[model samples]
Target: ELSGQWLAHVIQTMRLTYESLTALEIPNDMLQTIQDLILDLRVRCVMVTLQHTAEEIKRLAEKEDWIVDNEGLTSLPCQFEQCIVRSLQSLKGVLECKPGEASVFQQPKTQEEVCQLSIHIMQIFVHCLEQLSAKPDADVDTAHLSMDVSSPDLFGSIHEDISLTSEQRLLIVLSNCCYLERHTFLNIAEHFEKHNFQGIEKITQVSMASLKELDQRLFENYIELKADPIVGSLEPGIYAGYFDWKDCLPPTGVRNYLKEALVNIIAVHAEVFTISKELVPRVLSKVVEAVSEELSRLMQCVSSFSKNGALQARLEICALRDTVAVHLTSESKSSFKQALEALPQLSSGADKKLLEELLNKFKSSMHLQLTCFQAAAPPMMKT
Candidate 1:
């Protein structure tokens, strides 16, 4: 407590020094410059120091009238709500300030940086939730508490400069709200439900925007990546030389690269996919469709390197399977050979057994392709 007081005094002293520049009869331009620097220092200090989950930050936020919007937040249990809400209200002030065009500090944070900060804030909420959930006798069903946000005394000096727009900060707020913990998330979703609003919908909309940007990047770099790579057969037949088949699949791991971008964008934004009144299926389908479409486009540029088509692929499959059988046959797990031989493949294509000398080349795992004659699979359970 004494240390907290000392910290408060330190902040107050800095404020006094900030205000004292005017008494020095400094030029108005010079005063604004110093004030901007002071505000930056103050904001950085508050954000860093107030990160503790102790009562100090909550007390400070409460005492300074720093909270204002607290309708559904009451769902938070008292033990958990204090620090989370306090942290949220403390951070919210940064989003509230709106300055006229053409002011100062360093350049403002870009949209990506803002989203990253938003994600960090939500991570704190998740931590709080998990902390309470882990307690042996914790009761969460009846837990209800309230939170609010407004500017506080310590943070009063911090305001947006010319660089940040209110609209941009609002986006950050929405992004942060999209990832509330389960109970609070349900409360907020219920609010959204009443208003016909969907957080998942908004998140998907934002995701599509990002996807468009990535698509544009891919389109611009199409010629450079040579979307069309020449493919061929190792068997002595084709004359497509100078073209490497290894480059055929988007430089390796491109599918994962693109999927990872979308996954990262949504990871911090949606806590669970199953907790939706009407948004889960829509969101999942959209995600799968988007990836499938992009990957299909990439796949179009790929063709079989096998010069011999299905005949070649099936022969290779048979050879690979037979090899696994021979290596494991000598081991104590001898029944593995019978199981391996039963695997269905193009039965008419090639001999099931491989030559004894060929066993050395079969050190790798066998690959199997399963087919369903049905166009669509039936549900595992009755609807």
Candidate 2:
């Protein structure tokens, strides 16, 4: 007992001495000498302590907050929530608790506990948001908040000279939320659309535009890839002016190119089709909402161009329109049969009678076509 008490007193004395040395505002030369002395003392003490068991070392470590002085990456005091996340990263795939490592996603034993933990984290994020939203020159009271925002803080500071509108700030929030939970962010996006948050719609348009550009570039690369070697090798000069060999090479190139081209084309088209289906309705809605009434009406007219065409022509037109719209519309959405039905009746004459007869005979065909198009049209918001 006496020995243990003596050791504790020695430790405390060394700790205070170190603190006092650190607090001294000495000249650089004296400071370096003091720092070297402190390091030597610490190293000797640590070497002597190695004789202690692992459990003793661990207990000491736990009691001392050994990592509290980690390089000051942030102005804030050390945060418990961030500490938990960092611990998780350190132990990932290396250490496992008997039940499981605690995590934000682990199932809580009690609903109250789960709710409490969730609310705690949410409050932390909200507080961080408040700090970020303060005036550019406002002093951020980091001690008041919890949560990791290092990257966001850096990014926000770089843009401090410029003003961010509410929508832009909302976009930043949404982007961070996506990095956290993609599916949840998408659900929130849909809800924003439902609630008429048109900025969300604008974001959707921008996303679709990016996807479309990527698809186009990919397709061009694919085509050029397919065309290159075949076209190059088939040149007569390259083949030593052997016309027959040139013919053979061209045919071979065509065969290989077609095979690879077909696969690449399909892949590119599938990606574009998927993106178009996702973006068109969202984008189209925003465009229509923002455009002049004349432009909006023009779009509607173009959509209805063949409403008065002959039965076969109308059927083809309806099919095409439905294809574009179906990507945007929901499954429960009514088919756009009204567009077909809205075709004006012909004025009386032999031509009119012939048209009327044709319409009656192909009404079922028109209905089928309209059903197909309606299924296609109303879903996407693409341009």
Candidate 3:
């Protein structure tokens, strides 16, 4: 059943993509009405896909019912699912009527109409997820999940039935809401942060830039920027002001867990955005920490095993660990250099000497202890 659903969604997405491409080629004035229709259908398709994807995730979670029962599996995606649903549910009244040959259909009179028409297709795509699995009417509490479909006015009463992915759907809803009431984006961002939805937190962070398009409306919404000290001082330019991806640090100090999650998110953005220098060090530090921790764990596990080939595997693990550790050392060389450079400048000669001694102790440990352990391991096993 799951396989069939997956195939169906994939096929639908392909169909919509093809159709949208076709509309893109048609002359703007000649294809205005038809384009709106195509866009709406595409949105419906995206929603269907989101709903199905959410269902598949839920099915897998259910298959591991024992683990889920003992330690509840997260149902956070469902709330995102509903947000998409409400986005579509709110688009009902806003129809994309293409002006007849003599009609002024190509241009929208108000910003609201422009938003409704532009975002129509994407919203349909996200809302289609409702078909994936039956969802409860009441809310569920799960970490990193939030639903802000409470105010019908928030969506402005359109409730169209287009399909869209949760991401694309959220983008469409955000675009329209930001156009109508820029404050809505700020309010939603605050709400999601308070609730701890990291995914939405990142989304809202990027969407805040949409307000820069509005005149004085941008300053009016600046009140919401007061929440995050890190982002509050962000420069008010297109690239820096609202869409500044650098502000995405997870609020965690524990090195291991924080690094792992934060690094993955950074890697994803790096692939997408060609990340700026401001984002590079913060994310690279996390990546370095995560890789080191994983290597350490693998070596410890390999060290304890006594089975055939275990000795060889331990040696291979040691080599990998050394390689990662070296990479980290090289990346953090500047910090190491700064500390070493400050040693001679200390006012207290005795304190400076003590610091030098501690530095020498670290260098000796790295060479004597770590090198000896690596050498003691068996040779690497040939694959």
lDDT of each: 0.32, 0.32, 0.33
Candidate 2: lDDT of 301? 48
Question: Model 2 TM-score?
Answer: 0.24
- TM-score for all models, in order of appearance: 0.27, 0.24, 0.22
Model 3 C-alpha lDDT per residue in residues 270-290, reported as the tens digit of each score: 321221222223333434444
lDDT, residue 150, candidate 1 = 36
Model 1 worst lDDT window (10 residues): 365-374
On TM-score, the candidate that comes out on top is 1
Q: How accurate is candidate 3 locally (lDDT)?
A: 0.33
RMSD of 3: 22.5
RMSD, every candidate, angstroms? 21.1, 23.8, 22.5
Q: What does candidate 1's lDDT look like per residue over 1-383, in tens digits?
A: 22333444554565577567667887888767765654554445343534443433233222221111232222233333344454444433332323321211124453233334333433444443333323332222222112122333334322212222222222222222333332443443343233222243443344334433433433223212221121111111111344333333211111223223333324312322112212222232333333233333333333544222322232333342332222222331232233233333334422323222222232222111111101234557956
Which candidate achieves the best lDDT against the true structure? 3
